[model samples]
Each structure stands twice: as structure tokens, then as C-alpha cells.
Target chain A: MKKMMYISAVTEALAEEMERDESVFVIGEDVDIDGGVWNETAGLLERFGAKRVVGTPISEGAFTGLAAGAALTGLRPVVEFMYGDFIHVAMDQVANQIAKARLMFGGQAKMPVVIRLCACGAGTREGAQHSQFLESWFAHLPGFVVVAPSNAADGKGLMKSAIRSDLPVVFVESRQIYYDIQDVPEGEYTVPIGKAEILRPGEQVTLLSFGYACEKARQAAEMVKDKVDVEVIDLRTLKPLDTETIFKSVEKTGRLIVAHDSPAMCSIGAEVVRRVVAERFDYLDAPPVVVASKDVPIPFNDELEDYTVLSVQDIVDEIMKISVGII
Target chain B: MKKSSVASPSAEYFYRWMLAIRHSEQKLKELYIDHKIKGALHLSIGQEAVPVGVCAALSDGDKVFSTHRSHGHYIAKTHDIEGIMAELLGRATGCSNGYGGSMHLYNYEKGFLGGNGIVGGGISLALGAAFSAFYQNNGQIGVTFFGDGAANQGILHETLNLASLLKVPFLAVCENNGVAATTPVEKSTSETDRTKLAKAYKISSLSADGSDVEAVYAAASKAVAHLRAGKGPFLLNLRTCRWEPHCGIIKDTRDQKMLDDWRTNHDPLNVIAGRYPELLSSELRAEIGREVDARIEAAVAEAMTAPAPELAEYKRNFGV
Candidate 1:
């Protein structure tokens, strides 16, 4: 195992996957000479050359659509949407054309395209246009595999798995953690889609989250170490959710707290809360407390932006609030 | 009578396919009036020559992404008359297993990507397919067929620019039928000439009389040859006419004199028959007519009996 930055892990994953499969290539604005706006795809242009690492015009709809069309014709194209918020510009290509092609065409075509985007909502002062996290929007759509890995290891492994997948996948990454370093396993490895990893095991409270919120939940778990024995489950895949892992943890803990960076309304946490209530109503000792950002647009001011987003204190308070009398 | 000098050996096949499209659409109209095939149907009655000409220029490996008015495109490419009939009628044996109706025809093996519902949506799709061919180093070209309304879409401009910039082997054929649903092109678009839009993107383009299959064939052959030689994307703006309403059964809502003029001068079958009546002899015309009618009739009967999609089939398609 070697310690690597989150951005390095992603670039390494793309490099390894492209080397492994000749059909896999990266297409986006500034991916060639600029080496990606975030530099996650840096040095790939020199390694793969112009044809493989293409620099497209800032036409999101056209390029995203080009990836989909290429995927249908036997190329695994990883489309880079500089910001997750920009995905709305190409939603028709994502939701209508790419998603519906296989099903509406009676399963004649397989869409093997991955849309990688930076979805961090706080810090960097990038303002509202670039900082919104919209994974819930994609999870609601059929024929898409939505994933957001919180750490470098999972980021590299999940991206590899997403590239290998035959269906369309939306792999959301964070700008906040691009330089954050973590120990990633050496050699080829793939974290399977639609599975959860239990970071910490305990019996009092089950804390579930994904993306950057997973890190916040881990930090909160440490803060409330003496108050509540918290079990943190990282939901790797949002669409084909590992309900089994969630249910099993909830069964043992008898209390739940869902956390994510997006707004509380109809977010991934809301879906998790709904599923637990629907499937395991009897196992719950208290209502599932969801710790999510306030429902509002991300403000430009750093202080206001921090106020609207989730924090470790928020997770800790929610965990203690749900696990009443455990202290 | 004026004669056609275009005498390729494939003229017989082109006439048969065009006649097949014409007869099948007529049958679908009768079925729609009888309340058999439900939903909106965009019949390409007067614009059969565009698809026939463009498809004749393509090989089996090439792909065509079509628009909502796509019956002619589907028929010309695969000649799968039965599958298309079943698809329109929403039968299990349909190319899309009864899921895709008239506006959503798809057949991957024959390389008919789809009849997309969105205007100008197929341009990016076809461009992507062309890019894929270039990536694989395979000598395959992609053709997209859209209407005049789709020409005004922003994605068309974007795709045109991108396709030209990348120099992908692609063809964008605009079957300019003059009207978009109910609105005329003059009222809707400021730039009436769509080929100018292509030229602005630095892509080479040409225009042809869409009703004249020989002329359309000549234009498409030239464009296909250019694209095949690694030149770049080419655009063909076909001036054609639509003989039916935008959707549903053919209604007499169009101008009587205009419709009559188009029927007289630009009717695809009449244009060929008038030019070289011997090319379609009385016996050959009757034979083609009987064959088309019998095939459509048999397909309709089988489709009526074909089973509907089940719950498991839906689950399988969703990959659940």
C-alpha cells in the first residue's frame, strides 16, 4: 500500500484502465493540453496522445452525447464534466438518450459510458455555479449507476469498476478532497458497485453516508466515541443500493442517522430513511435522523456556504439525538 | 414523356424499396383509421427518395440515425418490412419488441440506431458513431436524417462544428419538407437555408431535388465518396415535400393546389414511372404492388396475434 492524493488515484485509475483496455479513452474540455481543469487527468495526454485523450470544445451536450454514441459503438468513454452542476446542460443526453437507448431499443445496445464530475459544495470559493452536489437527481433516473467514493482507495477502485461496467455510470468526485492523501492498495483492484463498506463497527447507532459526508460521519463517530458506539457504513453505489448491509446494521443498532452533503429534501439520505422505514419499521427504536445540508442554493460567501453544508458536529449531534440515553 | 438517363443496375431495387415504403405507409394509414395501430404516426409519404438515395449509398456496416418521420429510413436500410410493421402495431415480434412505436423504431443489427423523438437529437448520436468508427480505424460512416425544424436546433450547430473540427466521417441529410408540425419554415426560422448552417461550420454541403431519386442518389454518392476518402463530414439538404399531416392519419388539411402540384410533379413513384415507364413495367409494377400488399397483410395478421411483453421481459430490459 502507498499513500496517494485523491486526484492522483483517479488519474492513475484512468491510466491503468486505458492501458488495460484499448477501447477505453477520456474525452472532455481541456483534457488534452490542459490535462483536465482539475488536473486529475494530468499527464494523460502525453501518455495516451491526442486520439485517446481528446480535448473537446466546451460543448457539453455534443461531447457527452459523443461519448454515449461512442459507447454504443464499442468504446468505453469516460466523459469529464468539469463541474457536476454542468451535467444539467447535457441531461437530455444522460437521462433520455443514453439511459433509454438500451431499454427502449429492446436491449439491442449497451451504453458503457461514465460521466466523471467534481461535485464539492463547500470551500474553494468557486461560487454557486460550480459547487452543487446533484447525485440524487441521477439516482432517480433508471439505467444509470450512480457512485461517489469518499477516499482515494475507493475513488480509484470505484472508477475502475465504473469504467468496466456495461451500463452508464455517473461517478461523482469532490474538489474539497482532491489533494487529501490516503493509503491506496497497490496493483489492480476494483471496488464492486452496489455495495457498502462498514468503516467502524458498533452496536448503539448505525451512521450511513457516502461521498464527502462519509468522512464527516467518521469524524463525528470519533467525537462521540464515549457517548455512542456508532457503526459507519459507506454506501459506495447509490442506485442499486446495498440495502442488505444497511438493513443488517440497522437491525443490530436499532437506531439510524443518514448524512450527505446535498439538501435534505429527496436527497440520498431521504431515500435511505424511506427504505429503512418501509422495510425495517419494527427494528427502529427511534426515527431515522437525517444530517444533510439545509435546503437552499449554495451561497457565494464562505461562511454562509459552510453554514448550509453538513459538518462533523452536525453528524455527532444527530447521532446523539437518535441514540438517546445511550450515554 | 421525358426520360431518365440514370440507368444503374440498382434502379430496380431502389424502385421496389420506394414502392414498398409508399404501400406500407398507405396500409398503416388504413390501419390507423380503423383504430388498430394506436399513437401518433409520422408518415414520410412524399419524401421516400431521400432515404432511398442515402441508404443506397451506404454499406451494411454503416449506420443511420433517423428522426421521428423515419418509416422510410427503416424500410430502406433493412428491408425488414415485417419487423417495421410489427413495431408500428406494437407487436412482440416488433424490432423493439413492441416497446418502440412508429417514432422509436430501432434495429441494431441492420445499423438503424433509432428514430429519436427529439428534433436534431440524432446529429450528436450519429456524430458520436462516426467518431467511434474513426477511433476503431474502421472504414464506417454514420448518416443522420432530420427535418427542417431540427435544423434550427442548437445541438445541430454544435454537432456540426464538433464533427467538422474532428473531421469524423459523417453525413447529415436534412429532408427539408418545408413545415414543422403546423408552422411553416418561413414563420419559424430566420435562416431558411439549412445548408448554409452546415457551410458556416466549415463542413462541405450540397443540395438536391429530394423528389428525384436519381438526383438524390447522385448527390449522396458524391458526398459518401468524399467522406469515405477521409475528407470530413458532408451535409445534404434535400428539398422535399410531406404528403400527410405531421402525425396521425393523413388529413386533407394541406393546401389542395399545393398538394396536387406536389403529387403531380414530385410524387416519388410517378417521377420514376414517368421518366422510364419500362423500368417499372405494368407486369413489374403489379408484381411489386402485390408483393408489398401481401407482405404487409401477413405482417399485420401475425402482429395482431403476437403476445404482449411480460413482466419478466420488462425486468430483464431494466437489468433488475
Candidate 2:
């Protein structure tokens, strides 16, 4: 048994991959001396030295490209963009180069790189500039594997698998999950990417979410237990999504509700709806519903920000509405 | 940065690269005029010293990732003239099977990783490649090249911050020609000197005369040497001149005059070829020209003979 937290799980995952594969290493801001912005990589520099745990210049585009080159040259690299939004700067590296290199090059190249991004808004008073959920932006890309684990075990196992996968992986970790601890085995383990875990078994309504939203969804599941049987799905990997589990659950339950902190329009939610509507249209008793952040920039004020985002009450209320055919 | 007198043999190679690129420019311009090529082209007519100087410092194992303006990088790293030409011609034999056009040439055998279309995009990826170099314990490095316009991109600065803070063994070469689209570097950037921005990362940094082959070579050589000796990531700004009207054609006579003046008076290849008439006639020069023309003709023929990727084949590339 291990008592490691989510952040520690992330560190262990990277360290394990680095030890397991000679071609695996890490680079990002404050990763060497400070052990990364979130302390996930603490003590990594002392063990790996400056070469493997490389600190970079303030050139996101250049370093992102560097990582892609490294990935192409047979290295499995995990690069951290301190904030999720900062990934936009290195969009060329992730979306254009690393994501498209394999397909664009006619399968002549293999891009096995992991990009780690810390998404803010974990009930921390960090303001709008620092707090925004951008997983939908990356989920829109085809070649990328987006991982966001809400639990400690999934964080370690999924990250390890991401580093090992023969594709560009973007691991989105929630700031809320750092100290969030759960039971985990000390033995080596790997969680498969592109598979959603059914956290709770139910028969009335299915709630889909990942990362921080999973916890809220679980809470909403409890809140609506007497009202309806709400099945909760932890969609750890956003891209190359496990639509099978979702659709299967929706087919059985005849109702679906997607709950995430990200925006609604043109979001991962949109893709999920498209997938279900395309394949399992008759399964839905009514139009599927999505509870998400408002379609606007995340505000600075605490109350407004909270109002803009989804909560257990909001999710439970959405479930109640679906139960009563109110929506 | 290392400064040298203009009479070195390496200087000749640099100048020749510039001239060959110019020839490519002239050919591309004529093609555009003849309506043989489509899409907006971003030519590297005056930026010869950058690719030649930096690539000269790297070995075959060290990889290079480039941008939409990538013809110079393609030529600098390898001799895939036919493949590149076919790509420009939108032939099935093109590097990307005519799917990527000019912005996605990928030649892995020669360590040319990719030609990306996004600005400031491939930097982290290059750093990742260097990370692999460091992990594999390979005596190799990854060189990622971008432009001055890319500097304004937030990712470029973030990548620098991470590379410096992490000490990744990647080298960043900024070919600053003072333009991002129609916007000049001075107007867009509060600090026109990009090297200073690199220095803020507190990593090893330098700026060089990007137009001068010898200068860029010296600076890049030192950085590569530092990388070879197990130093961290390094940043270098190449202060060069762009001798084309962005690419292909220009309606502005002033732009045309600038392009013409740069082509005629400041041709890097002609500068060296003029200096070394003996070397100019040497077997190496003959080999380069012959190789270039033959490859170009082969590509044109291949493109003309081949079929476009059929609709049935679109599923292969499009991931439908």
C-alpha cells in the first residue's frame, strides 16, 4: 500500500518512466531547482541532474519544438507548461508539429511525447488570468492523448502509460488534486489511456466528467441517489475518448448529462454529444444535457467565478431536471 | 559571438547556400508568375547564413525542426530537392503526399523533423527532442529554428523560461529578419533586440549577424560545443536580412527594389563564388549545381507524371 498524494503520484510516474526507459526525460519551467511549479517534480533534479531534467529558456515555441524533435529522435519526453493557458504559446509544437508529425509524415515518424499542464481553479483564489480550463482546445486535436486524473492512482498509472504510449500525450492535472490522496498499490501499475472508468454503478442517469469535476459529480450522484440512480463516469482521458462506456451507459440509463468545468459550446461536451447522437440517438429519452462553466471568460470575483462554474448543487439540480423532464 | 574576416572557406559554403536559395527564389518567382505554384509562399531568400551556419555545427544525428518558412532549413539539413520540389508541385510523391504542401515537409532519415505552419510552435518539441538526446545519452542535440515574428508569440517566451529554468540541452536559433507578416519587429516588439529577451531567462545567450555566415557559424559552433560539453540549452538571435517580398511576388516596387538589391549586391553565394573562382570551378561546386538541377528536373517530372492523392486515398491522410 502507498499513501502518496496525486502530485506525488505524478512525480513517481515520471521517475518510474525515466528509470524504466532510457529514452525518457523531462523539461519545463522551475522543474530543476524548484521541482516544478506544483512540487510534483521535487528532488528530480538531484537524482537526474541537469541533463535529463532540463530547465529551458522562456521560449515556449522553441522548447516545445525541441521536445517534439526529441520525441521524433526516440526519446519519451514530458514537458510541463506551468499553466494550462500557457500551452497556447507552444500550440505549434503540440497541435501542429507533435500532433500531426506522424499522420502528416505518412506514418514515417513517431511522436511519443507527454506535455504536462496544470489547470487552475481548484477552489484557490488564483484569479481569472491564472485559472481557466482549456482541455477542450486540446481534445479537439486528433493525434493527442489528453489525460486528467482526479485520483492519485489514476494520476500515476495513466501518466506512466502516457509516457509509454507511442503518441503525443497531453496530461492535464488539476491544481485541486495535488494533495488529494487515495489508496494505491506500491507495485508497478499502468492505467490504460482512452478508457473511462465507471466510478459508480447506476441505472437511471449517467453523469460524465473528469479531473476536478469527477469529485463534484460524485457528490451530485449522492445528492440525487434518492431522486434517481445516477451513474458517474471518470473520463480521465479526454481525447481518443472512451465513448463506448459513455454510450453504453446512456443506452441502459436512457439519459446522459455531461458535467465539466470547461465551457459548453464547441467543447469536449459538444464532441461527446455528437458521438452519442450519431451512434446511440434512440437511446436518449430526451435531449442530453450538459452542465458547464458559462460561455464567457472566467471572472475574477470569487462569487461570480463560483457562479460561472458548476457545483454539486448545480449538477444535482441538472440531474433532478432530467429526472422530471424539466429541461 | 565569433567574428571573422570574410575570406574563410566555410564562408564560401555559407555564401553558396545563400546563392542556391536565391536561385530557388528566382525559380519560385518565375513559377508563381507562370501560375505553376499555388498558395502564399514564405521564402527565406536572405536568411541563408542561419540554416547553413547552425546546421554546419550539428551532426547527422542531431535533428532540426523548422517553420512554415522552411525551404532553407530543408536544403541546409539534407539533399531532398526532388522530394521538396514535388511537395511544392502538389505531387503524390511529395514529402507529405501533397497533403501538407509547403508547410509540412517531413524527412526523418536526414533528421529534419518537420516543417510546421504555426508561429513559435515547435520550440518545446525541439526541447523534447533534446530531452531524448539527454535521456538516450546520445552525443546529439536538437536544433529548432524560428523567426523574429515568432518572438511575439507567448509560447516562445514560455518555452525559453522552461528551457532556461530546466537546463534542457536544446539550442534555439531565432532568425530575426524584422518582420511578422507586414509588421516590422520594431513596431511589434517593445524590445527590438531579441537576444536580450533570451538573456532574461538567465541561460547562455547570444545574438549574431544572421546575414554573415562566418559570424553565425562562430556563434553556433560555440553553442554546440557548449552543448557537446554537456551544457544546458542556449539561445542565439540571428540578425539577418530578408531579400524577398515575403515570398514569390510583390506589387511594391520599393519591396522589389530591396529584394533586387539584396539579390544582386548581397548575394552570399556570389560573394564567396566571386572570391574563390578556383573553388567555384572545383568538383564540389560542379557536384552541387548538377545535383540541384537534376533533382529539380526529376521532381518536376515526377509531379507531372504522378496523380494527386485520390479521394479514396484521402481517408489515409485525413484520419476520417
Candidate 3:
């Protein structure tokens, strides 16, 4: 096993995948010579050369659509959207073309494209544009497979799986956890796209989250361990969600709390809560809760951004509220 | 119109294809009026030469991405009228299995990528295909066909810049049909000369009389040659006229006199027939028209009887 940061793990995965498959190439703004704004694709240009590691002009829609086109013609293109918010610039290509290409073409085409989005959290004070977790937008789309890993190992494993999948995958990364280090397995290993990991097991209530919020959920679980037994689940894949794991944990705990850094209204957390309520109504001890950011643009100030986003205290408080009498 | 040294065989081939597309479109119009084919139908009635001419310059391995008014492009590229007919009829035998109607047609095996619903949507896609061909060192090229209206879309300029910078084997064929939907090109942009769009990007540009099949074919051949020689991308603007409305069975809102003048003087079929009377005589043209009509009828008959796509098949496409 080798210890690496979350960002390095992503870079390692891209390098390994490019080495393994000739068809796999990297394309985006400043991804080649600059190695990416976050260095998530560092050293790819030298290793893969200019043909495979392309540094595109700042035309997101064109390059994104170009990547989709390349994917259609038997090349696997990994598109990097410098920031998660920049997906809006390429939404038509992302939501309309890439996501709908396969099914709209009657499954005649295989869109094996991976769109890697970085800087997907609020605490760094990048303001509304740069610091938004928009995975729910992709999760709502039908054809896309959305995956957000919270740590190094899952980051490496999930990225490999995403690159090899026949369908288009959206890889959401958080700047908040880029430097967070963890032990990734040596050699080759892949985390399945639709599987969730049980980070911590307990019996009182279930705390499910993804991306950087998973780290917060763990902290919240640790804080409430003496008063309430909490089960923390890292939902690695947002769509084709690991509902089996969620349902099993909710069924065991008899209570649920879905958390994420994205907004509360019409969010992935809401979808998770809805599913648990609809399917596991009999298994519920109390109403399922969604601990998410407020439905507003992220502020530029550090304190204001923290207020807008979900905090560890918020998860702990929600857990205490739901486990009041049960614990 | 400049005279061309096009051969007799090529002239006949172009005439036959133009007639087939014209007849198929007219048949589709009749079917729509008779409540046989439902949904939006955008016909390239007078603009058949653009697709036929451009496709003539492309090999079977070359990719062609087209716009919503793409029946002509699909027919010209793949000659799979029955498959496209089935698709328009929403049948399981359709090219896209009834999922995509008139606007979305894809036949990958025949190198026809698709006809996009959005304006300028296929430009970048074609660029990618061209990029793939260049990256793999394959002797293939990518061609995208869009109307004048789509030329104003931001994606077109963006793709042009990218294609020029990347030096991919890409060809952008803009069929300037005078108007975009209902808005005239004069009203849409200050620079009505669409060729300047490519020229600004430092890419090679060419203009052709879209109504003249020989001229369009000649221009397309030049553009294809330039692309094949690793000369980056080339933009060919085919000045044509749209006989039908932008979409559906809507009445043509343009000036009737202008439309009549175009039909009389600039009709692609008449232009070809008039230019090549020795090859496409009145009697020969009549025979080709009859054959095309019969094929369209047979395709319509087959599509009308084909089974509708099953719900289970659609559910299977949903990966979740």
C-alpha cells in the first residue's frame, strides 16, 4: 500500500489509465503544460505527449462537445472543467449531447467519456462561481453516471472505473480534500461505480454523505458516538446510487439523515431521503432528515461560506434531534 | 454560374441523387399532410445539392454530421431511405430504433454520425471525429453540414477556432439557405458573408452556388482535398434556398415571388437537368423521378407496417 493525497491519487489514476489504454487522452484548459489548476493532471503532457494530452483554448462548450464527438468515434476523452461551476458553460453539451447521445441514438453509440470537475466545495471562499457542488444536476440527468470520492483510495479506484465504463461518467472532485492523505492499495484496484462504503458502523441512526461532506459526517459521527450510535456511509457514486447499502443501514438503524455540501432543495440528499421514506417507511422510527447547504449562492467571505454550507455541528445536531428518545 | 468540366457519369449520379432526395422529401410532405407521419418535419426540398455535393466528395470511412433538416444528408450518405423512413415513422426498424425522429438520425456503421436537433450542435462533434482520425493517423476526415441560421451560433466560431488551432482533418459545410427559421441572415448578424467566419479563424474558405450541383461538388472536392492534405480545416459556404418552412407543415412565410423565382431559376433539379441535358434528358429525368417515387413509396409502406419499439427496450437503455 502507498500513502497519497487525494489529488495525487487522481493524477496517478489518469497516468495509469493512459498507460494502459492508447485511446484514453486528456483534454481541457491548461491541463497539458500547466498540469491543471489543481495539478490533478500533473505530468500527463510529458508522458502522453501533445497528441494525447491536449491543452485546449478556454472554450468549454466547444472542447466538451469535441470530447463527446471523439468519444463517439472510438476515443476515450477525459475532459477537465477547471472548476465545477464551469460546467454551466458546457451544460448544453454535457446535459444535452453527452448524456443523451447513447440512448437518443438507440444505444448505437458507446459514450465512454469522463468529465473531471474540480473545486466543488464552499469553505475556501472562491465565491458562488468556483465553489459549488453541482453533482445533483448531473445525477438528475438520465444517462450520466455521477461519482464523488472523499478520499485518496476511492478517488484512484473510482476514476479508473469511470474511465473504463462504456457510459459517460461525471467525476466530481473537491478542492477541500485535495491534500487529504490516505493509504491507497498498491498495483491495480478499482472501486465499483455503484457501491457505497460503510465508513463507520453503529445502530442508532444512519448518516449518509458523499464527497468532502463524508469527512464531515465522520467527524459528526465521532462527536455523537457517546450519546447516539451513528452509522456513517460514504456514498461514492451519486447516481445509480448504492441504495442497497443505504436501505440496509436505514433498515438497521430505523432512522436516516442525508447530508451533502450542495443545496437542500431538489438535491441528491432530498432524493435519498425520498427513496428511504418511500421504500423503508415500515423501517422508520422517525422522519428522515436532509442536512444540506441553504438554497443560495455561496458567498465570498469565509464565515458566510461556512454558514451557507453544511457543518459537522449541523450533522451532529440533526443526529441528536432524530435520536432524542431512541438513544 | 461558372462552367464545370464534370464527367457525364458523375453528372448523372448527382442528378439521380438530387432527384431521389427531392422525391423523398415531397413524399414525406404528402405523408405529413395525410396524417401518416407525425411530429416535426424539416425538409430540404430545394437544398438537396448541398448534401449530395458534399457527400460526393467524402469516402465511406469519412464521417458526416448534419443538422435538423438532414433527410437529404442521411439519404445521400448512407442511401438507407428505408431506415430513416422507419425512424421518422417511430418504428423499431428505424436507424435509431424509433428513439430519435426526424431531428436525431444516427447510422454509425455507414459513417453518418447524426443529425442534431440543436443549431450548431454537430460542429464540435465533427471536430472530435476529425481529431480522432488525425490522432490515430487514419486517412479519414469529418464533415458537418449546417444551415446559415446555425452559422450565427457561438459553437460554430468556437469550433472553427479549435479546428484551425488543432489542424484536424475537418470540413465545415454551411448551406446558407438565406434565412434561419424565420429570421433572415441580414437580420441575424452584421457580417452576412458566412465565409468570413472561417477566414477570421485563419482557416481556408470557399463559396459555391448551392443550387448548382456541379459548383457545390467542385467546391466540396477542393475543401476535401485541402483537408486530406493536412491543411487543417476548410469551410465551404453553399448559397442555397429553402423551399419549405423551417420545420413542421408550416406555410412558407418568405416572399412568394422570391420563392417562385428560385423554384423557376435556381431549383437544384432543374439546374442540374438544364446544365446536363445530354446526360439528363427530359425523358431520362422523368424515368429517374419515377424510380425515386417508387422507392419512396416502398420505404413508406415498409415503415408504416414495421413494429413499434417495445417499452422494455427503452427501459433497458436507462442505465440506472
Model number with the top DockQ: 3
lDDT scores for all predictions? Answer: 0.87, 0.77, 0.89
TM-score rank order? 3, 1, 2
Kindly provide the TM-score of model 1 when superposed on the true structure, using C-alpha atoms: 0.97
Task: Please give the DockQ score of every candidate, comma-separated.
Answer: 0.70, 0.46, 0.79
Candidate 3 structure quality by residue, lDDT tens digits, A1-327: 898988989889999999999999999998876778888878888888999989999999999988999999999999999898998998878988999888878889889999999888888877889888889889888898999999999999999999999999999998889998889986688999999999999998999999999999999999988888899999999988899999999999999999999988888889998898889999999999999998899999878887898999999899999997876
Whole-structure CA lDDT of model 3: 0.89
DockQ of candidate 3, scored on C-alphas against the true complex (2 decimals)? 0.79
- Candidate 3: residue B127 Cα off by (Å): 0.7
Candidate 2 segments exceeding 4 Å error? A1-3, A33-39, A55-66, A82-92, A296-306, A325-327, B1-20, B46-58, B119-137, B144-242, B253-260, B278-291, B307-318
Best by lDDT: 3
Candidate 2 chain A weakest lDDT stretch, 10 residues: A119-128
Q: What's the TM-score of every candidate structure?
A: 0.97, 0.84, 0.98
For each candidate, give the interface RMSD after superposing the true interface residues on Cα.
1.0, 3.4, 0.8
What residue pairs clash in candidate 3, if any at all? none
lDDT of 1 by residue, B276-318 (tens): 7887788887898888889888888888888876669787667
TM-score (chain A only) of candidate 2 = 0.96
* Tens digits of lDDT, candidate 3, B30-107: 888887788889999999888888888787788999888999999998888899889988999999999898889999
